[model samples]
Target: MHICFICDEYPPAPHGGSGSSYRDLSEGLVAQGHQVTVVGVYKNPQWHGGKGVDETINGVRVVRLPSSPSWLRYKLQTLSDRLKISRWLKCEHQKNPFDIIEASDYGGWLRFGGPAGVPTIVRIRGSNYFFDVELKRNGDPFEHKIEEAALARADFIGSVSRYASERTLDICKLSHRSCTVIHNAVDMDLFSPSPGVSRERGLIVFVNSINPKKGIEQLIDAMNVVCAKFPEAKLAVIGQDTQKPVDGITYVEKLKQRMKPEFLDRVIFTGRMDRYKGVLDYLRRAHICCYPSHMETFGIAAIEAMSIGKPTIFSETGPGPEVIEHGVSGLLCNPHDALDLADKIVAILSSDELAERLGTNARCRVETLFNKKHWVQRNVEFYERCISSNSHENGRCGCK
Candidate 1:
């Protein structure tokens, strides 16, 4: 079966969950002996040789279209480009007809898929309702429109979590049967925890982009409290500022300023990494993993840390609560509570026996939940079903 992926995000230029999520799916599909082509937007084209057409990289065929000025300059424009992507794919259909088209997000699939006569599935990353909750009101109408269309028009829909799946219906006013929930998979080999892997007295690793929604500020505040007790504690941050620095809104800088002076000095920023090498290296070097994000649809970083036998502390929201079985895998604190996070960080760092036990279980959990070979087979079977369904639909000549 041939699968065409219309993904809004991909690696080197990060767009959070969608980029990493599509990468994992692409690799898994290839291993399962399926032909897959990805269409994504690249922030900079010069790095990819020539951008507007097909280029194979990392064993996956990718076509990156030049993102329009609107897509590049403003958030609203990016969400509004489903028609643009639809037109691009429609033109490409002449060169080679796609058997199954999968849109990893709402914007394009919502606008593009039905027109193509292809059975389209838009994998919901999460619902924009969270964005509404964050803003204390509804999100942008343009963003809302795409998600609504995707939910209404998609031949089938899948979401990252049950929470996200249900929320999709609520936001779009669709039925319960409208979407299926498919959890993301992890590469257990890369993320398994190492036993007795102790670093210097207090090394805390905080990965993910340095943004407010990620709850980095709360993590920093919690670390401040924990650091006072263990003065040697250091929090190593392994992501960069995702947005262009606005005049008065420097989130990362603000975090540093608010943190205790001594604790802030211990916080090392490694910027955004192009690949997993830098992240893997830092994870191995750290004594513990601290993730305080509230809006994570799935906490892959924390899951990866667990696979590596490292005990992780994360929030009680979304994937965090789903993955960390509290005291079983690691500890779960309130999403943005500084006091709660501080207590957990200190407790994990102080206890060698507990950390060792949690690390072992964490690694085991990754094997059970995210085994690569297991997922590869599942994806292959799913692709076959999608193709079969498409063939069946096309051949139907009931009432003319």
Candidate 2:
């Protein structure tokens, strides 16, 4: 099957979980003898200078379009960008028709008419509404409207988690049949426990952008409690601050200032490590992985840690409970409660047997549910179903 992915972030781009997840799926599909092409937008001025580039990365053909913004047309920029993407897709489609064009909800391109006639699938990796509510941001009303419009036109919508799917449907008032839940995959081979890397005793790692929604403040507060019980315990924060300061100080700086003088020495902030190697390196060394995020469509970092056989702790909020079985596979903490997070962290640290049991269970759970092969196969089947359904409806495989 021939598939094309339209996403704003891809490899070598300032990406988060969505970018990495898309790249993994595309590359996995290509390896399974499927033709995959990715159409992405590059806007990072520092890296690519917002210039278009076409290249093949690990078997997947990636075409990046320049997204250099024009302040003069700021209000109409989104519409113009969508038009530009649509034109590019049309041109690409002429060269080689795609069976399915999966456009991510990240950039709201599908809200406008996507490539004309292509069976477009809007894969929602947390909609704008979800982020606005979760992150407590008053986003542009026009952007939300644009996303709603795009979702309405999608032939099929896939979400990384049931929580995400249900929330998007409720917020957007989308039809039940339009969206389906598909959990994100983790590369088990790449994330398995490393024998070469020695684990750090009492090291608690948090891997995500240092932002309020990520529950960074809660984690920091929890660390204070954690250190009181276990003085040897250390917190390794790995990720950059994606958002600016809500107050006068940046979140990173605020965290630094908030930490007590004594406990400050126990905390280490390694801002934005190399996702490919750096993250895995940190995970391999850490004794416990804590992801107390306020909301997540699917917690990729948590799963990655679980895949590495690390006893992971996630917030009960959002999709964490869906993936983790509380004390069985991994521990779950209250998103806003620092004491609860600290208690959970202490529970694992105090009991070596419990930690091992949870870690082993987590590894098994990831292998059973979040395996890359299963993810790729599920996506391929979904694409086929969407194509078949489109063919039946339009007397062809393409959208009308």
Which candidate achieves the best lDDT against the true structure?
Answer: 2
lDDT of 2 by residue, 269-388 (tens): 999999768888989999999999998889899999999999999989889888899999999999899989999999999999999999999999999999987999999889888888
Q: Count the backbone clashes (under 3 Å) in each candidate.
A: 8, 1
Highest TM-score against the true fold, candidate: 2
What lDDT would candidate 1 get against the real structure? 0.71
RMSD, each candidate, Å? Answer: 3.4, 2.0
Worst 10 residues of 1 by lDDT: 391-400
Instruction: List TM-scores for all candidates, in order.
Output: 0.89, 0.95
Candidate 2 lDDT score at position 281? 90
List the candidate 1 regions with Cα displacement exceeding 4 Å. Answer: 42-51, 69-80, 106-109, 114-116, 127-130, 134-138, 193-198, 243-249, 390-400
TM-score of 1: 0.89
Worst 10 residues of 2 by lDDT: 391-400
